[model samples]
Target: MTQQELQARYEAVMMNAFGAPKRVFERGEGIHLWDADGRRYLDLLSGLAVTGLGHAHPGVTAAITAQLGSLGHVSNFFASQPQVRLAERLAALTGHPDARVFFTNSGTEANEAAFKLTRLTGRTKVIAMEGAFHGRTMGALALTANPKYREPFEPLPGEVVFVPFGDEAALRAAADERTAAILIETVQGENGVVPVPDGFLAASRRIADEVGALLWIDEVQTGLGRCGEYLAHQADGVSADLITLAKGLGNGFPVGACIATGRAASLLQPGQHGTTFGGNPVAAAAGNAVLDALEGGVLENARATGAWLAWAIEALGHPRIEGVRGRGMLLGVVLTRDVAAQVADAALKAGYVINAPRPGVLRLAPPLIATPEDLAGFVEALPGLLDAHG
Candidate 1:
């Protein structure tokens, strides 16, 4: 069907929450997507950083096909080989061999499991960072600090406090013995790829330790090589008691996990938490494939290409670009003005895709496997896109 016809049908049948559709994509390859009219566009956002291995990866496709044919999902009643292996692999990737994992279907669900684990500490007070974007679920939403998203959903789960992000003093003042957990994103994804200040996370760890609060880092958007590391938190060398992941864990397949280390891992026993389709065999297999790609130099591509993109964008000398912030592939080009949304729309028309998490910041987290040519093309097109927007 044409894009307009499909959009019309979607609006009539689908919920109005997401508002109008932007474009209808039919197929995708590495770093590129084709719309209903077959017009191609370079994918710089990577489906909000979930397509780390890019679209239609051969290894991932093969793994999914083989696993689906053998055994897809057996529910939580029984165990699966892929599930066990994936869990162990995930824990090992975190650099904590003894870390235990609880799988879920999305990032928010993984966080929800972590939230319940926090409650097992006998405290409901959570100290989260301002400008944080946890998830949309009631529990996750409660932890999210954006007033715009939370104002409409008032009376959410309570005892959640928001402190200025990356401010050690604020965090130290807010976290006390009563705080159950201090959740943060090493790099705030939805807040325009802003990396936490140096020594900020280390201070968080120290504070959480002193106050008996769990240090939970939300790696949902920055894990699994999205930032050229197994997880963005790895760069800090500070370990979290609970680490949540999802976006890139299963590549394109839906999967989420809450990994807890040390005593935190023992908090939620069988009956305490459960998910019907969390560790389904298919999702496990997909997770394994994603890890394989990460271990097989897809991560290196993300680093190299991301660095190249950063340098190229900087060299553009565009008047609108104020600065660039972030690490590896997760980057935010901060505009001098609040025209990010318009620039994003212009980017789409110019055969590229990007997002605006903040009004003045254009965020880009392209596929980890994006070729240098694709990266260069986006860089080359960016100046024109910004010019048009201006």
Candidate 2:
């Protein structure tokens, strides 16, 4: 069907939460996507950073095809090989060999599960940073603290207190025995890819330890090789009591996991928490395949290409460009004016795809498999796009 026809049908049937769809994409390969009209555009957004390995990855497709051909799902009543193995691998990634995992189908669900786990500590108070986007669920929204996202769903659950992002003094003053967990995203992607101040994570760990509160790192956007690390928090040199992951976990497949270690691991008993499609065999297979590709050499590519792309963009010396922030492939272009949205729209017409998370910040989260050469096109076109739009 045509893009216009599909959009009309979508607007009629869909909830309209995300507005009209951008375009009816016919297919995608590697770092490029083709709409139904046959126009090609570089996929810098990576489907909001979920398609880590890019579309139509051979291994991921083969794994999903193979898994579905044999055994799709047997439910949580019985154990499946892919589910068990993926759980083991995920637990190990948390740096806790015996860490426990509660699987979900999306990052929001993982955050919701983690939200419930915090109540097990007998504390409803959660310390979350301002400008942090946890999720839209009622439980996760309490920890999110965004007025636009939370005000509509007022009377949220939990005693979630908001603090200035990266303020050590505010965090230290807010913490006490009543606090359940200090939730933070090492890199606040929603706030224009802003990474916390240096030594912030370590300081949070110290404060949480002193107050006997759990340190929960929300790596949903920055994990799974997106930031050139197995887990973005690894670079902080502080281990979290709870870690939630998704987005790039299953590449494009829907899969999420909330991991807990030490005393936090045993909070959920047999009937405490569960999900039906969280770690189904097909999802597990996709996750395992992405993990394999990431571990093999895609991570290194992300690190190298990310560094080069960031440098290359800066080297352009465009007058509208202010600077760049964030780690690895997930970057935010700081613009001199609040025309990021216009630039992004212009970029879409120019055969590139990007988004403005904030008024003056354009977020670029390409697939992990993107090479420097693949990104050079976007980098070269950015100055003209910004000039025409900014």
Candidate 3:
């Protein structure tokens, strides 16, 4: 019943993969969460950018209820209306009407599917950006460049190269005819919410084309209106051969998709890949509800409120606060010192929930529905919080 009790039980049974639980969240609504102790906190992380529609969203709940009451899941052997409709919606959103969708249950699985799709290009090498975090699975892990995450799992899938995140020349040098795909994150979310350098994406596209490699953009954290756009790469006017999505796709519902466009759409053949519960009706319905909410002013609010939050943070001009980086709701508050962990802990005590993805970077991905008032409160509290920790 209490946070400590739940934490004890969790540690006794759970795998300890994520360390100790921060708090036992009992319930949430909009951008707020209540722990088991009945303490309330402003949730700025949005469950690591998954809850775009926020907790217990009425539209998302209603869609899930209706779909479950009607037809929940029918396996991949048979198609369901919601599943087919969601696929069409994703294809259209990709700016490639004829793009094919391969559904998965999580972002990692989506990246796994994309990894396999790359192999179908008759090439073996995959060039991924440095400081990239694709996923944890074996195939996706190979593409992830973090040494800490990859060292434990030795002899991972081979022929994977890592290049500087925003270096066009490095990418050009790494890519070649043998490169099956060039995987990149439009904005490196796990790498402190860093945005891709200007012109880097377009340059990557051109280089990939010259090398006959598929350009794969990982939009798991920046897609579905999280970064003020459907796909962050779209703002750069660069189209990818394969785009992997997940985090905000189902608004907290477990769902992901690998969208393949142009000739790459036909790469994966029948029996080559399969999923037991990838595009079930329930997840599809939830995905549709998230899209509905995004279309209905949530996206515009993200753009407006995000700009306001960035401006407010900059206006503080605190000595410890370096600057704010990122687009839309996905932001990272940079600090002059590597005390982000202390700041985040202090923020928790001050009734706020944020994350220090790096030693000096605090990542903020509040719900898309968060208002300017909510962000203003965080900005106002941030200075004192940093001072206390610093």
Best first by lDDT, ranked: 3, 2, 1
Clashes of 2: 0
Off by over 4 Å in 2: none
Clashes of 3: 0
Model 3 Cα displacement at 278 (Å)?
0.2
Q: Compose the digit string of candidate 1's lDDT tens values, residues 1-390.
A: 899999999999998989998999999987789999889999989899899888998888999999999999899999999999999998987777679999999999999999999999999899999899999999999999889889899999869999999889999999888999999998998988899999999999999999999999999998888888987887888999999999998878999999999889889877988999999999999999888878788778888888888888888888999888888899999999899999999888888899999999999999888777867877877888888777
> How would you encode candidate 2's per-residue C-alpha lDDT over 1-390 as one tens digit per residue?
788988899899999799888788999998889998898989999998899899999999999999999999888888789998999999999888769988899999999999889989998889999999999988888888668988988888888899999899999999999999999998999889999889999999999999999999999999999999989998889999999999999888999999999999999988888899889999999989988888788889889888998899999999999999889989999999999989998998888889999999999999988998899989999999988975
TM-score per candidate: 0.98, 0.98, 0.99
Cα RMSD, each candidate: 0.9, 0.9, 0.8
Lowest summed lDDT over 10 consecutive residues: which window, candidate 1? 370-379
Those runs of model 3 whose alpha carbons end farther than 4 Å from true positions after fitting are: none
Q: List the residue pairs that clash in candidate 3.
A: none
lDDT of 3 at 229: 89
Kindly list the per-residue Cα lDDT of model 3 for residues 346-375, writing each as its tens digit. 999889999998999999999998998877
Candidate 1 at residue 230, lDDT? Answer: 89
> Top lDDT: which candidate number?
3
